[model samples]
Target: MGLCLLISCGESGKRTSVDPGTDTQDISSEESKPVNTPGKKTIVFFGNSLTAGMGLEPEESFPARVQEKIDSLDMDYKVVNAGISGETTAGGESRISWLMRDRVDIFVLELGANDGLRGIPLSETRENLQAIIDTVKNHYPDVKIVLAGMQIPPNMGPEYTAEFREIFPDLARANQAYLIPFLLEDVAGIPELNQADGIHPTVEGQRKVAQNVWEILKPIL
Candidate 1:
């Protein structure tokens, strides 16, 4: 995943992947726009820039793609992309309460990559993530959760990177959350699949990413 995927996840505290990354990634930066039909159960994807689809168009992002997949099944499920570029577990923890305003039937957690890139303490990052989970559970007691795991380059050191990589599975096991082994999966580190930045996935790559997520999300739905 060159600088783009590296930065897309966290980018060593840099916004090089997509300068001035977008704040929230829904169907449109235009909050007023409605991507899903009304009166549907909502599935909220909450995470960082990778979840935000950094450089890709709203419809090309995985969350949006998931929406398309859901619609194709004729399901009345709405996908809400609450992705904030450059967001870390701490950032997500602080904001989880507010974002749960909707009645989320499914809450997909995609945070912590930035914390890994920034080399934040694993314990602290874990705690913040757990806090976010706790908040989500508090809000929606019956909500199904999907945790998206992320990875960083070896430059962060093998021991640290290994520990960082284990965070998601550990959280999933502890919370009984459905785990997506890796968010980027077949997309990360693939030159052609990623945008020029080497971080964010290209449209083709996003299609694969969406499929990766849908496999896990579909079963839950």
Candidate 2:
């Protein structure tokens, strides 16, 4: 796959072929505008900047796009963008409780990309992700989960990259959750789909991402 350049970019500071570091600020509090409707269920997109729509407007993000699709179909569900730029699995695990306060019917997990970029231990990443999943399950036993898979360049060695890619599906299977083979799919590594940073997706790219998620998410709804 040409997804070697599909590494999630949000963490600020140094950059690399694998790490297109941008912003690592946590904005989930402001971005995750959860609307509670009496009868409507909720779909919470929990992840990093790619989920946050870093350089783009909040509505331009894939979660918002998913919301648009749901509304167009008159689905009885609202989307909550709980994405924070530059969030690692550890960070997400730490704050998972805060997000759990709201009712979550469908939970989409999109972390671990930054951990891959930072060369965090694969075991550690897996553990944190599992913990996050466990937290969500503890809060809402009936909530459905959709895990977003990610890929990184071979900068961290082919073994590391390959294993990093396997974490998502393995976890999804173990937890009996749904999986999006690769979150970026057609949008990654394509210069036209990304912004000037050549990392984060542009508006059109976000739309493609939404389609990718929809393919799997649609069946669940």
Candidate 3:
């Protein structure tokens, strides 16, 4: 089982874009305003290598890039990169308590990619993810959750691929979490944006991912 850890960052950079319809933007002009007063709000991203920045620098990862964008927008929130390289949903479920140690205002759950890659039972993956959601909600009822969906390679077989693809939305609805239909979006399958492994994203690819996540994140922020 894989386990992704989240990290906090302090940085700023240019804005990125995601696909239309799913895109979200900020309307507030102020930067770093207190979102809830007194304490700072932290958004934790939970997942595997995709969220862990396996082949990329910590700063180049999508979570960091999103943090930079959020800072620029003046949203008083902290982005925590809790991505564990090679982690599965089962691994994530086991670490929810430690991960949620902080006062997490939101959670961006991005697990199950490795589970799909390893051909783990979809039912098992669903059970693990649902448990993670339940635990997080039980501990932090006010924490907003954003479920990052994934797609498997077509070679995984049509039936399995379809089931794997449907898990994210189903979990999002059941848990009442915000859904980002696909984490890779324009980045995945685009040879230019991906690294040599064809698994992780290039620097440009991560930027595209940040944009992809931002679209759904902006509205919630």
Top candidate on lDDT is 2
Model 3 residue runs over 4 Å out of place are: 1-38
Backbone clashes under 3 angstroms, per model: 7, 1, 14
Candidate 3 colliding pairs, count: 14
lDDT of 2: 0.84
Candidate 3: 10-residue stretch with minimal lDDT: 2-11
Return the lDDT, model 1, position 190: 86
lDDT string for model 3 (91-158, tens) is 67876766654577888999887677667899999999999998888889998999998887755688
- Candidate 1 off by > 4 Å: 1-5, 9-38
lDDT of 1 by residue, 105-177 (tens): 8889998877777788999999999999999899889999999988888778889989998999999999999
Model 2 per-residue lDDT at 1: 47
Report how far residue 193 has shifted in candidate 1, in Å: 0.3
lDDT of 2 by residue, 52-127 (tens): 7877877888999999999999999989888776678887787887788778999999999889988999999999
lDDT of 2 at 30: 48
Where does candidate 1 clash, by residue pair? 1-189, 4-197, 4-198, 4-199, 5-198, 5-199, 7-11
Candidate number with the higher TM-score (2 or 3):
2
